[model samples]
Target chain A: MPDSEAAVRKRIRGLLAQLYGGDSFVETVSDGISLRQAGVSSHALVALLVAMEDEFGFEWDDDVRPEALRSIESLAGHVLSLQE
Target chain B: MSGYANLARLDLAYREDRRIRVRDGVELYYETRGEGTPITLLNAFFLPSPSWRVFTEELAGSYRVVGYDLCNHGKSSHVGPEPTWEEHAADLIALLDGLEIESTHLIAASTSTILARDVALRHPDRVRGVVLAGPVFGPRGMRRQRQVQRAWLRTLESHGIAGLYEHMYPEVFSAEMNEAIGTPGFLGFREAFSALSTVDDLVNGLNRAMEDVGDPAVLAGVERPALVVVGDDDFLMGPTAARELAALFPHGRAEIMPKAGHVPFVDDAEGFQAIVRKFFEEVDARA
Candidate 1:
């Protein structure tokens, strides 16, 4: 991964940990892991989005297709797209 | 009859019926009256269709006014394991599908405003415009509000109907209105309040559903034309919050009703109805 992609992934993993209270982000994302499978419930997903918005200063679009958030990598990619 | 003059001549007609098997397979209870463009009204927290009587009556002649009890409130069945805003939105979607409504305006008050925004964001095709009154995204400073809401819920669970009334009546409306309206309205309000007054009901479901609500960031994304109404004297949600809420909608405008409290329709039915009618007409004309 490029340095910027790696930093975004690190930030996402930290957010996931803060929201879900687990330390498996690195292990789980060895090949990337679905957020739902990583135990991110809808409630936690909302909290995560709130955290992301606070960190990035933008609103996360709720209307976006849920399938787009399949994994940490995908989630980071979505966030990066928003940043651009 | 002119819309404003027709206020006192209000006549209310409503139907209570069930329709089965939408594509989503959710059974819904829907009530409707009058004809023209359809307008769906979503009730505030713990309020039912009867509370919407004045607003509905005033608008019926000019538009199709439909309002339904969310699953756990009013006459609707609490057959579900739990209630969430998404489920509430889905129920609305199903109701529209069952009624064969292609597009309609949505007016929501209090907590239902949360659901209305969700529907507009997720199913924009079905929604032509929206009006959110006394909007509550999530309770600010969740810790304390959650505790109070939970305590109220527990009081209701243990005290049955009467206990719930004691805890909820003061917070819902002014103490003076409760005294003036006497036992009948108080009893009705109690019944409506208790229907969803439980900690589990709110914390696990309603609160979660409310999570997506009231954020200006979320409201800004809603491209539909919107009107926000707030009461100047509203004790629960004030004018400042209403102004903040209005700023969220890209096409949002706000009106403040003088001397009105939380439930503006109940507090000033005539003025409230006129504002609502005018807003709907303006949105329709623009469209």
Candidate 2:
């Protein structure tokens, strides 16, 4: 991943933390951790995507999978792939 | 009876209570009125089924109107843990099966547009046409989604549900109408908002289901005629989004409600009803 995309990952983690209410769950948002399992509500997922759009200034195309929002790493990879 | 008492009695007389059991034994609150072709009314996320009473009555004058509370909203059975959009669509189809209705037209507002679109796309044989007001579209560049998320997050975090209502009022109604109509209804809204004050589960679940259905591809294959209506002043879903939504469907068109906001039905009921009535009439004629 490019340094810019990696930077986005870190920012998204922080944003998710704020969105999910800064619980202990935020500390464990590893790439493999499922966002749903990590207690990221659907609303948070939307907020995260919205936050990503604002931060990256790019919209997701129709071809993108909704499941990409499953994990932090998965979402980052998807966003980064879009950037590429 | 006094004049006020007579009016109340008349309203009570017109209301016909009905319910249908969907799949998984979820009981849904629904009402049917008027006659002729059927039209199903989908509930807005926050607004319960009864909130559509005025529009349902207006449309019922000429057509058969069916309005129902989705599972866990209003008086509907709350049986699910966390149902997905697909499951919600199943419930709707099951409702139709229970009612023994073959096919019907659909009208939805705000996030409920997702439900209507999903059902119509999956079961074209079961849906005649669709009318979406303040229609929510799939991810269109994520700007609008982000805007919605930010506004909602701010409310949930700082003010809770009460604060959320204040934040949502302007988005749902025009500034002038907010004072004229919304203010007068605040007391009743207070009771409703209070009930929703701690309803985090319902809110989050519904939001998640809506997100699942936000894929634009879902509507790409919808062949039914669609009318996308948006108020000129609706801050939540603007004209651009409405037009984009219309473009997604093969036979879709967009209409603007001048000087109205998110809930145009409340601000200008007659105007909104006229537009919808005309749209359905045209759809029928084309058929």
RMSD list, candidates in order? 22.4, 17.4
**TM-score of every candidate relative to the true structure:** 0.64, 0.68
Cα TM-score of candidate 2? 0.68
Provide fnat values for all models in the order shown. 0.00, 0.00
Error of 2 at A64 (Å): 46
Kindly list the per-residue Cα lDDT of model 2 for residues B1-287, writing each as its tens digit.
22111111111111445788786567888888888898999876576665566555668888888888777776777775656777778888998888788888999987788788888888888988899888766326334754675667667677666666666766766765655432223322332444532456446644564465366766778989998888888886777777887888899998988877876676667677788999999988888
Report how far off residue B71 is in candidate 2 (Å).
0.9
Write candidate 1's Cα lDDT for B1-287 as tens digits. Answer: 32222222222223456543433434555678789899998976565665575556767888888877666555565554656677878888887887889989998886677788889998988998898776655224224334555675567557654575566556655444544544433433333344433544443343453345244567767888878777776655677767766776788888887756556665666677788888888888988
> How do the residues A1-84 of candidate 1 rate in per-residue lDDT, one tens digit apiece?
233777877887787777656775545654276655554443355456657667656665424444445666876787777766
- Model 2 Cα displacement at A47 (Å)? 38
Which residue runs of candidate 2 sit more than 4 Å off their true CA positions? A1-84, B1-17, B138-143, B182-188, B195-198
| lDDT, residue A58, candidate 1 | 64
